[model samples]
Target chain A: MNLRKLFAGAAVAAVALPVIAVSAPAGELTIPSLVYRTGPYAPNGIPFANGYADYWNLLNERDGGIEGSKINLIECETAYNTQQGVECYESTKGEGAGALVYQPLSTGITYQLIPKASADKIPVFSMGYGRTSAANGKVFEWIFNFPATYWDGATAIVQYIGDREGGMDKLKGKKLALVYHNSAYGKEPIRTLEVMAEKYGYELMLLPVDHPGQEQKATWLQVRRERPDWVMMWGWGVMNQVAIKEAASIRYPMDRFIGVWWSASENDVLPAGAGADGYLAAAVHAPGADFPVHADILKHLYDKNKGAGERDRVGEVLYNRGLAAAMWTSEAIRTAMKMHNTKDPTAAQVRDGFENLKVSEARLKELGLEGFTYGIEISCANHSGPGRAAIQQWDAKAKKWSIVSKFYDRMPEITGPLIEADSSAYAKENNITARSCN
Target chain B: MGGEFLFFIETTISGLMAGVMYALVALGFVLIFKASGIFNFAQGVLALFAGLTLVGLMEKFGLPPWAAIIATVGVMIVLAWLIERLVLQYLVNQDPIILFMSTIGLAYVLEGLGDIMWGSDVKVLEIGIPQGAVDWLLDDYGLYIEKLEIVAAVTGAIMVTGLAVFFNKTRIGRALRAVADDHQAALSVGISLRTIWVIVWSVSGIVALVAGVMWGSKSGVQFSLSLIALKALPVLILGGFTSIPGAIVGGLIIGVGEKWAEIYIGSLVGGAIENWFAYVLALGFLLFRPQGLFGERIIERV
Candidate 1:
């Protein structure tokens, strides 16, 4: 063979070495983790994946596998690409006793998997992302985006801005620029913001940053010209860090600039150092490793040196978000097990469990996450529970984020009709009947 | 000044500075292509690896910033030498496409290696360069200008001047030029092809380091920094692959054009045109001046 052929062969071998197929043993409850561990978004994706894996490992190590069925967490690396996420989903869906649920951790991936998972009878817990209309479980039955959605985030951010300006009526004639990543994920909140703009009379300026947003000189220059009263971002991964840096470089007041939950993380703010101080973002959970679940994770995982990430990063914002996602999914599994009266409940039973899920404040306290997040209550019609979030400020000197506001419940007046309209449109296009919950 | 004119001035100045940043990465590509006739796809990854190494040294080994930077330069040189020996040496007389493919492979290997050596986490690379907006510009002229962008502009100027001097005023530089003209003839005339290749690659590596430091400081040192290579591709296309000065001028034109397009025209089209606007301008350049503004016209006889 030629030298070119030889080198090509070697390259193929190098690439194929690390890809070990995940096959679970029988009688185990498999959870397909569609993770992006090696990509542009790895900085944020790493902690979340670690947190997610650590939680499942904690369940396996401490609770003897979520009430006697060993948890089989099969992590498939997506590299944050939509096609790779679908490939991961297809490859891992039939691992062992079949996959119970999927937490794709990506809006693009979630959008793609919504119909696929629905048809396959597998449930997708997109957490705070995916299509905001997916919150209408009557149309999007198998997909669950609980706790909050992007539309909820937009309204909450607007509410916070209005409160800062004294009242909702004070927002009239004010300019608010939405610097968002130019994708389905980033554009998720635009409709809600536009409606809010119409209602409150704030002039909305939209600036879209493309994927892996490393260069933003043009976008920020526009921000300087527009000189908006407040700036809100719906960015993710490197876009968040770059946007924050650009905002700081233009002497934009960091306090007036806010980011979505996905944009708020140590990875996003720490790079800007002292300039990021007072930069705010919406949060659904408390940060830091002070929670009892973190202590248990420390004991059952990190203390034994079996943690998925660094021992110190147990309670980071994204890590906690991931841990919370895992906690709720596992709770749904337990609910399925109890309702079905079997340890090995099917994927359909898990869907039922998620539909009927209600994690009250008392249960949160019992789970050692009492103050970490608000109570969740899901129903057949409402996959999005509470849809509430609080604003958090970054203290760059201390290198930590602290919640600074009470959880603001989403405006049903705004999102209800929008969700109904969008989901109804989706149902009409797909020729599917919306399920009646009542 | 009228508010519209001030905004225009602000946009132009910012675009020039952003262009200078893109030119910094393009210079490395120009260097390797000038000497070897092979487009080095690994240049951006080289920048990323250098930044990763510099930050990794400071964090992992507790080295001071100066020491870590010096050590990173040393690492880049050694890496250049290794690339020369392992990859380039074996593919010496092969097709240029083969060489280009090798660099693509090299890019992935270095990216993965950087991730493995220093875990794939966003690292704040603080060598104490001034960041944030320049206060006097903002206060006096009411113009927003980044201190880091100013620093990048000066750094790009110094690098270009030094490289021009090095390429035009040295014996080794002449040897590189001779090799660029005709590798076989240069070898026959006692100009060592291997030594010239190694030298060109080392210079490119240092360029990568400087580009990495500037860009990494702006947006924390991460894997996405490697994607800045995409920004430079248009620069190379418009400016000519083999001219360093062409890179800067092309970068400025593309930058100002895109920024103006995005600001003026983008608003009408619902925005986000800056990403594709650069490539479109480069395509226009390709259609008009395929040889680029500064690139030498080939006079091949039939």
Candidate 2:
């Protein structure tokens, strides 16, 4: 009789284990942040990860959770490697409330995750950087690169140059050099730049620097020889700093030398000292910690000693970018709940919410991000919101970046056709039908 | 000369300066290989560690530059003694492959310890090294040369001369040469092989620190400073592993050869050929002369 009783208890325990493993905790939204706090890119990755974690913490602490459903933020270290990022996504995607959304923060990992996330019915918010073609929502139903994309950045750069060179007509016969990291991320904007070059009649000089670009003596020597009218950089990590320093070494005009968004940061310029003064970079949002959202973060997180990183580095450019990404993510979650009429919406419902998401100027002010960035509205037809960018100059003496130009409008005439062609090719390859907005 | 010919000359001069930097790193490797018969793969990380320590001492502890440098040197000496006592003592008489693998593990340990000590954020290593293009060079001959590179070249020359004098004239240098020839024979002669290993590693540590300071100043002190080891590898292969002069000659050849290839040959294949051009040159050289330009030729009987 005792043996039979024991066997019955064991059988019940065995049946409950798998059920417990599969089920998410009730009334909690789990958002897994794949971060890199180690490795070569840690200097840049740490602040971004910290800003992301702090924003979520601010939402949970100050607001008592978004609509009373507390957020369970889980951080997994990826070290900025794509393989590790995929593993992080696989391990954390099914935890607590089924992972409402994902922000891979890496283009290589985003490319790897686009199909997986689509099949899993999860929304991917690549924010500003990813496959620019994913902006066409007809094919990329689950992927969103709101605010801007790399191709948009390239167009904005060209537009800014056109404005500086007197006019689009004045761009003819001008030599522009591109010193880019040799990677998919660096190569993404080439075709768009080539198209713009053809239309504008500017000579494009392409220079590729291998990964972990510490040595640029040869590349800069070529830059010296060519004597291009303007130099543009598509660089990241140590590459940006080294390129800036090398340019400074060669007495390249700081004002004319521009960098894509990733290449422009306090981390990049601070190392180059006074030589980095007047360095220009394309920006998607205003820099510095003056926003009201920063105050709320300080009150809710840093004041309570729960801040994710150094308190002094709270409002720097990359930190603010991370905060902006988290804001969009949380707002999307709120939108999902409101549309579904349920506090605990699954990842698929959140994807639906993303497809119809809109954040206006009023909403931006309400969220304490007034004048921080432009409004974003993601829809079925458009995954990239507005695709506007501005130029910012690094003032090394002041140790800050200030907006030096108005937002350059996204050139849809050029980018639209490119996006359509690429997304159509991708759709055909994957056998995916383009979905209609209506 | 035509404008294009002048540009080629300017590129060659720049390439030669870059080669001198690579040779500085290779010099550290040659020192350890000569005395200890170990490749000392951690030489690059040792440079990084030294830079991190020097920067940490100055920034965190607020030591004066001179005091911080001296303290860093002391730290390297202690590290050398510790490595000898802890790692080399246990691994003595091991196969060359095993010793090489141990140094790789040591590299990782040093790298982690460096990050933990200095924090991972890139720090400006301003040791008062003058930077920017030399005005005189640019104006006189239309040749652009960085002041920092000229300083590095002068420093490298001084270091090489000092090393040559020490190795040829000192009694300790003789002892080190005896140990390099035969460990058992050195022990029989009561030269203390272990002491010679510690001294040799300490000297290598000093060389690494010098290379680190130069590189850390050129670029910020960061993790990538350790990658100079990869650059030094082809130098070691070209200049026989045991020859100091060979390292210098090999570095210049690889550097100038790669630059010329990237400029002239790289365009045919869409540029960026400097990355692999050096390794290919070294490989081609090895096919013809298995014993490098300066490496001691080895003969064996079955």
Candidate 3:
């Protein structure tokens, strides 16, 4: 209780607090993993989370971390809730020299973080999902949705349908129904699809299925009533399985029915049993763990009993998507390190690396990912890369997906104007000046 | 018949079938409510637990569908007994709201326990129930109805009949009704309220299993199976919380009304309104008939 003793204790405590609470030591890279491993979406979320974590761990184990610096992964569970996602971002953004980048797996979370992460100078990689107009990097300078956007997926689907009917001209007067989850994520493709419908002269029917879509009998019955020539789905979680089952039960030709990349996963198709055969979906990467990177992951992680998920699940669709996300982020990190000549690059340096990212086919081969996915090139002007994807068909009996067609090039003629219009409006509303890439 | 009329009939039939599924879940709620006057919020989680257990048994131990169902039934019965002993016994004379709040807690506990016991993954539940559309209906009448929906309807009818008989005729059932009527009086009359609670919960557990199977067959067993309870909430509100028969009738009305509204009126409003249409109809019924169609009106002295 003496004043001298209290002052001594206070001085000791003040010194200890900073020592204990200091963010990760120098030369360690901090990556925040906003994951949803429990909840209704956990079925889809768990595999992706595992794959993402395991890939980062693989780099640490195989190469002694990215350029021998080691990675500090701060995994905070979001449970797929936007509010929780923001909390996770706030809590972990300042850890380990600051978060180099954020890969928010949920579109809702991505939209919420776009401005927040941008203002914080932290790059957000939504990767295939999120605000599609973030592809216009001039407006969304810190957000990157490379490989493809929902708009690209929509156009690719329509292009595939056009090719199937022999030509784009054959799509005239055809009825295309979109059974989508009634959320921001699902509504992203509506404008793009509507524009494509007008261009191709097809009738676009919109059927929105509410959240946690379990009772879809009414929606499917309407499908039978209208008998649209093609049904395209933009669904996730339980909605995907239910839609596929209902579509199968109605004996809708599974081949004619296609789903966006989010809807195409083993978890989505296997639930419907044999009926999900011949189902088609858009894919940014090839399915299966036969790629060399998977072998390295198995040897370095699973073989050492350090794998994040069940070993058998490593090659699944969502797992591969997660691994791909990690791979791309790590490459950007490497690019940042090289650009700055430091193993520990800051968030701004990482954002610059993302802007100048280039993963050519030869580099993909060097990374043991040859044929796993197509090449990606990012620039200050074009953050969306090629926005290319191939069509994959689910073989129910074999219980696998195979690439059935070549990657479809982006329909710039359709998406370019739409992105400009949407991004410009976004810039105007938010009072954000478009950054000049040049 | 005209195409529009035929379509209407088809939609009505489909609605009724869909109602049967909702009623299946509501039946569990009614069973618990009829016995303990507690609306078991964990009923849907119980169904999800049952489905997860059945699939877990099949995948882990290499059991066939029949063996898995039998094993899952035992697990559910044990779970019901545990809930009665560990949870309900402590809150025997507590307010109904307290008991209801306890079940909400129990829902989270059971949900987390199910996840721990059998990992949270989408499981395919193929217990040999026929799926896809009925060919004869499609070929003969140009109507599309699922074989699985027919199976669900038939199973529901049998379950309702069996439950009705059990509640009206059996000695344990009379004891259950007495306990529900007056717990203290039934205890004074040598009726073991604890025993009745165990039996009622066990029976409800079985009903939950049946519902789990039907829904799991439809959409693959996952966490969303628990959210199907949301669909049953309006059904419980419309069909008195205490009446089994009301569950079926209320379910049919809500199902048909929602489907018809979605198809006929939803298009004009940009669709996806079926999720809320059932609740709106139930709200209207709440305004007109607070006691519901088949629910008993109690006379209490002030």
**Highest-scoring model, DockQ:** 1
Per-residue lDDT over B109-134 for candidate 3, one digit per residue giving the tens place of the 0 to 100 score? 99999999998899998789998999
Per-residue lDDT of model 2, residues B1-302, tens digit only: 58789889978887788888888899999999988789898999999999989988999989988999999999999999999998998888899888889999999999899987888888888778898889888888778888888887888889888888878889998888888888889889899878988898899999999889988887788777898888888888898888888888998888888889888888678777887898999998899877788998888889
**Model 3 lDDT per residue over A208-293, tens place:** 99999998988998999889999999999999999999999888999999999999999999999889999999999989999999
Clashes of each: 0, 0, 0
Rank order (by DockQ, best first)? 1, 3, 2
* Candidate 3 docking classification: medium
Of candidate 3 chain A, the 10-residue stretch with the lowest lDDT total is A15-24
Off by over 4 Å in 2: A1-24
User: How displaced is residue B25 in candidate 2, in Å?
Assistant: 1.9
Model 2 TM-score on a 0 to 1 scale: 0.95
Candidate 1 lDDT, tens digit per residue, A305-411? 99999998889999999999999999999999888888888999999999889899999999888898999989999999999999999999889999998899999
**Model 3 chain B lDDT-worst window of ten:** B290-299
For each prediction in turn, the share of the native Cα contacts (below 8 Å between chains A and B) that it retains comes to: 0.88, 0.58, 0.85
Superposing all C-alpha atoms, what RMSD in Å does each candidate have to the true structure?
3.4, 3.7, 2.8
Q: What is the lDDT of residue B45 in candidate 3?
A: 96
Better-scoring candidate (lDDT), 1 or 2: 1
